[model samples]
Target: MAADELKLENQVCFALYAASRAVTSLYRPALDALGLTYPQYLVMLVLWERGPVLVKELGQALDLDSGTLSPLLKRLEAAGLVRRQRCAEDERAVRVYPTDEGGALRDRAMSVPRKLSGATGMGLAELEALRENLVRLTEEITAQQD
Candidate 1:
């Protein structure tokens, strides 16, 4: 059964990929009501957690490079959900901040996590532990790549 190692069902990457897509799909309806896509919602989460951040920093936090992030930021700006401004002391650096409307949306978005948690039928502690393990696995893989 050596060939079994190559089977799709035995691939950890495929499992994670499938799980990610499934989780993202579950977020769709909730995100749609917020007028935000999954990536946009992620950006908002970072902003809501950390008031304002530089474009470079935001990119790093999201594990996205400028090429992929720029379009998302543009759409977010177009929606008036976020504002991008050049830093006064560093013209080359752009900082992103949530606009008033975006800040207001935070209150309504609070229910999203609770809803998703209930959908999982898992307790907070279990989810948190799983999240920690996933983060560790991601970090290990990333470090290996580096």
Candidate 2:
């Protein structure tokens, strides 16, 4: 109690962690309706944005390591949402792309962000500014780590 920095309530990490969980929980119902987990939703987001991306590029975009990404991709493939194939030029490299069903899911996913944004009770501009700040913070910290 003597040092504010030592208090859990005063920790930025705790705030970020709590906020992340809360926001994720808000997405649960919507994502469940779409038959996607949060992580799966993230992968789909990347796939939806950039079709036919290298597995390594996907891993980097999602900031997930192979150990974590491999299983997730396998599950998605099993679900028939995505497919993995070896690159034609480089047999050692793998590429991931959404299936027809996966691409169709994009239409349903259009409402997800709007729903989450509404839940936040923040205006579009305010939400954008907040997102920009968060991205800057992440980039700065990640740069320091590297």
Candidate 3:
């Protein structure tokens, strides 16, 4: 390949990175309306699906550290969306549970996926293919990390 042809646009990593940012950007305005960031929205999803879960498990699920997640969890608590409680089995462990407000937020948030899908102009099958590819890529990256 020519030196000039080896530019950043030609790199798959760059493309993926840019696409990820772009997709996240599309969510920003919508998320902002709900007073949440992308990471916070992810945390809500996890709580909605799993209910009261440990803080460490949340970090692992989101690939975040305590340094990052602690403050976020605190903010969620302050917002009345979630509550943090010490685990009975382990005083050192903190568990997160969504409040009624948080659970109700899911009803409002249910429209988001459909709105995003419409914005992307991708049909269900195409979206599924994209999701599958991304999942494979994520697994490969996680394997490399190990």
Candidate 4:
């Protein structure tokens, strides 16, 4: 029946949502060891790759809004990991930069991906393909918002 098609177990969105929560939960223990939440870890990963970045740029990279990012940045600052400084060229914009301690945490965080991959029991090629598909899915959905 048509009504049967509406079951929660049949929804793609529900599957993605459940998987996302499970993955984040799995990362909790490893991230907690670094004194970072999953969201904080994401911010740190961007900072580690790009060095100092404007808050707005960071938001774009993480698909997060200022309201959500503000508290995370504040917590990072409070923990002595990152510093937020007013950009000299654009005084209205704030740039976030990692401190020496934050950079040092990179070494400890390096094992996280490996540990997570092992837990998933998926080969690198399969994971890479899955990531590609998910990225395409995200881009297509995001384009629809335009």
Best by lDDT: 4
**Per-model C-alpha RMSD:** 1.7, 2.0, 2.2, 1.7
Clashing pairs in 4: none
Give me the overall lDDT of model 4: 0.94
Among residues 3 or more apart in sequence or in different chains, the pairs in candidate 1 whose N, CA or C atoms overlap within 3 Å are: none
In Å, residue 36's CA in model 3 sits off its true spot by: 1.0
* Number of backbone collisions per candidate: 0, 0, 0, 0
For model 4, how does the per-residue alpha-carbon lDDT over 97-140 read when each residue is reduced to its tens digit?
99999999999999998788888888889989989999999999
Model 2 regions lying over 4 Å from their true place:
5-10
Better of 2 and 4 by TM-score: 4
- Report the lDDT tens digits of candidate 3 across residue range 1-146: 67667775478778898888999999988888888899999999999999999999998999899999999999999999999999999999999999999999999888877678778877889989989998998999899987
Deviating ranges (above 4 Å) for candidate 1: 1-10
TM-score per candidate, chains pooled = 0.91, 0.91, 0.89, 0.93
Residue 108 of model 4: what lDDT? Answer: 98
Indicate which candidate wins on TM-score. 4
lDDT of 2 at 90: 100
